[model samples]
Target: MQGITGYELSSRKAEYLKYIHMQGDVVKTTEIAANFSVAPSTATKTLAEIAKAGYIEHTPYHGVRLTPTGTAYARFLVRRHRIVALVLSHYGLEPDEACKEAKKIEPCVSKSLTDRICASLGHPMMSVCGEIEHDCCCCCPSGDHET
Candidate 1:
């Protein structure tokens, strides 16, 4: 209930956070459930747990949104996931396949590793899927820097 702290995030919570970052803004439990092929109740329960952890906002029946802290964490995960996808694609995997592989690998990667991978990828700006890359450059780099 304290949310995920110091490596306590379950795979499901990580997935949910990634989904929220991918979707942007607020998302409904049903939408989240459908994305994961889980029951709405399951999504609701997960959301409630995350909310208790201070990583999300739940407004009874309106929907769910990430709090600032949650958004920062979710963005961190998304950036890492997309960078992994970009690096994997460079290694010759098809775009879609690379994305799937990145999703599978993202959680296991540390922030430091993700930062190094992003740098190694030349600070890619977008994933092969057309989604924006979630890296430090995207957040803080000047336009003069090469992607």
Candidate 2:
């Protein structure tokens, strides 16, 4: 978690990580290609880069799974998105609109900023999109901190 921040990945790569995280299991390269509307070879190349960065383990003829570092990073990505979208909703955007807009804005937001925003929002446990997960590395109250 120390080295894996939400800022280091490109929007596309981060999206792929988020997608894989959401899937909750190994995902085929072809499935990724289909999800992003890219060629399988393109997915492979990009995934290679991701794997090189230590975010995933890719096996030939099999699929990819997030490393522990990747899992933590992806979770942060999801938390960042939900918190930002919740803020957008509070600022008058509809729930769906806020969610869509968050996807566009999330890549620009940092973990520190997200943590501050989450703290300001009283450590909300739910967002318009889903339940929020807190990490003690950031906004959790001292009493609520978890290992």
Candidate 3:
């Protein structure tokens, strides 16, 4: 598809993007491998695949960096996850527990579904994980965020 990341993206892929983006610098193969508990080779292979999809730049044995497309997708995924966690917390799940549940739930959340949820939640400004902000187009037609 021709959306943010240019494909029918996976949340697992989204997770990788978010992790890399959060690092605020090039993320080494070793770091990603350790964080995800996978062998370095496995992490390399995964990174290569995403790179092929054009959301990141990966250099073998070196590190990975997000493309602009990757950044937009990561932001969207984070927003979706925070919203899911927030809603679950309202059902009595502890913040941490809700975050955990949200991880499992994030992969299946579609854009329209996310829009509905974010609206229902009254566009909450913070979540257990920290500040929550949606991709401007997700709901904010004006593309404005409070700074």
Compared with the true structure, all predictions reach lDDT values of: 0.74, 0.86, 0.78
Superior by TM-score: candidate 2 or candidate 3: 2
Q: Which tens-of-lDDT digit does each residue in 33-130 have in candidate 1? A: 89999998888998999899878998767788899888777767666677788888989999999998987777787766766666665666788766
Residue by residue across 4-117, what tens digits does model 2's lDDT show?
446888999999999999988899999999999999999999999999988899996698999988888888889899999999999999999999999999999988888888
lDDT of 3: 0.78
For residue 77, give model 3's deviation from the true position in Å: 0.7
Predicted candidate 3 versus true structure: per-residue lDDT over 5-112, tens digit per residue: 322467667788889988977999999999999999998888999899887999876799988877777777777788889888989999989999999977787767
* Sort order, lDDT high to low: 2, 3, 1
lDDT of 3 at 114: 76
